[model samples]
Target: MDQGIVKLLPAVRGIAREAGEVILRYYTDTVTAHVKADGSPVTAADNAAEAVILPALHHLTPDIPVISEEQHAAGKSPPGDHGTYWLVDPLDGTKGFIEHTGEFTVNIGLIKDGVPVLGVMYLPVDGDTYAAAGPGTAVYGARARHDVPISCRVVPADGLVVLSSRRHGDRERLDKFLEGKLVKEHRHSSSALKFCLIARGEVDIYPRFGPTCEWDTAAGHAILLAAGGSIETPDGQSLAYGKPRYLNGEFIAYGRK
Candidate 1:
């Protein structure tokens, strides 16, 4: 691991935890939810969490620009070619959060050269924090004070399992994809947790055929890759970060070495 990234881990973890707390406060309250111009949902918790996380990240590395979901929805873009930047989804799985499912997450990722170099996904309800830098990844359940190494399971074909999205699901395509394959079917999960499930070796694949932004998947992708897994477009190209529009194409996250 790069020494600089190692140095950055503490601050990243702190910001993620703080942001998670901010989201949780609203999670337990009666909050208002609205749709953005793009027709995606947003809530007060999302803004509150971003307010806490963005500034903390800037303070940690003043030179690096940040691109956050709330900021982008407000038409704010990262100002310069930083070579390295922070990608944030302060509150992911807002629909689930609004429904009081406690499955939302605060995602923070460091991207360099169009790829995530470090990432953190924090679940406030459970106090589980998943982090990765380079090729090292771990899951820390904050309340439990336990750290578990995270890695994808290399299951044989017979044991293959796929995790899909519950909210933004595509049933027809998914059924077609799995028609001939011998695998177990599981219900979809929300947010980056789906990717984390694959990273932790609980699922073999996650194929998302619906729309998603860069911030939505970058952190999870980084952690998954660090955990000896890979995510790619359906065409088999590795998903790249820092695209011109910040929108991601449909992709498949695979649990494999």
Candidate 2:
């Protein structure tokens, strides 16, 4: 684990929380959604949150370039990638936020050489934060309490507790993917919070068959890895970042085996 990355957890977590607070300010009022070029919805909260995160990250790690959802969507992305860069989804689960599901989150992750080394995910509605930097650093924090350690749990002998995306993915594909597995319970979740749940051992597996960008998964991916969990393609290869247009493919996130 890089000590430099470890040292970054605190500031990154603060940045995430700061963005979450910005989102909350808009979330409390009427959140009007507008369609982007890709036909996905974007709200004032998302832009407002990104407005908070981008400069703070630049001030914190001036050399590390940031690839943020709103900026990328607007075709304002920086040219070329640094070996180390910040991936920011100021407000993930925009659909859930629009629907008032209270499942949205603020995400920040540091990717080093195509791997996520640090992350901070903040749930604005509840003031809960999940974060980590390298192995053994995973933690769950809240407004009143901060840095309570957390890790993934081994799958139980009874069955696997699975989570599926609430608004995306094909149900047929998910069912086929789960065929023959011992599924004790299945539930729907929004945003990157699925990865946080798996990181804290609240769930066993989350299989993502839907389309997602790199920013969507990076933060949660870092926290889950720190918690002794893993994310991989269905064939069991490590997921790589820094793809063209920052896109992602289908993958499965698993807790401790």
Lowest summed lDDT across 10 adjacent residues in model 2 is found at 22-31
Q: Model 1, range 1-257, lDDT digits (tens) per residue?
A: 77798679878988999988878877665768898888878998899999999889888999889999999888897765656888999999998898888889999988898888888999999888888888865454566687778888887666578898878888899888877777765767888898889888889998899989989988888899899888899888999887776899989999883
For model 2 the local lDDT of residue 173 reads 91
lDDT of 1: 0.85
Per-residue CA lDDT of model 2 for 1-257, tens digit only, reads 89988998888888888888888878755779999989999999999999999999999989999999999988888899678999999999999999888999999999999999999999999999998999999999988885799999999999999999878868899899889999999998889999999999889999998778999999999999999999998889989899998999899999997
Return the clash pairs for model 1, or none: none
In order, the Cα lDDT scores of the candidates are: 0.85, 0.92
| Alpha-carbon runs more than 4 Å astray in model 2 | none
> Deviation in angstroms for 152 in model 2?
0.9
Q: Cα lDDT for residue 215, model 1?
A: 93
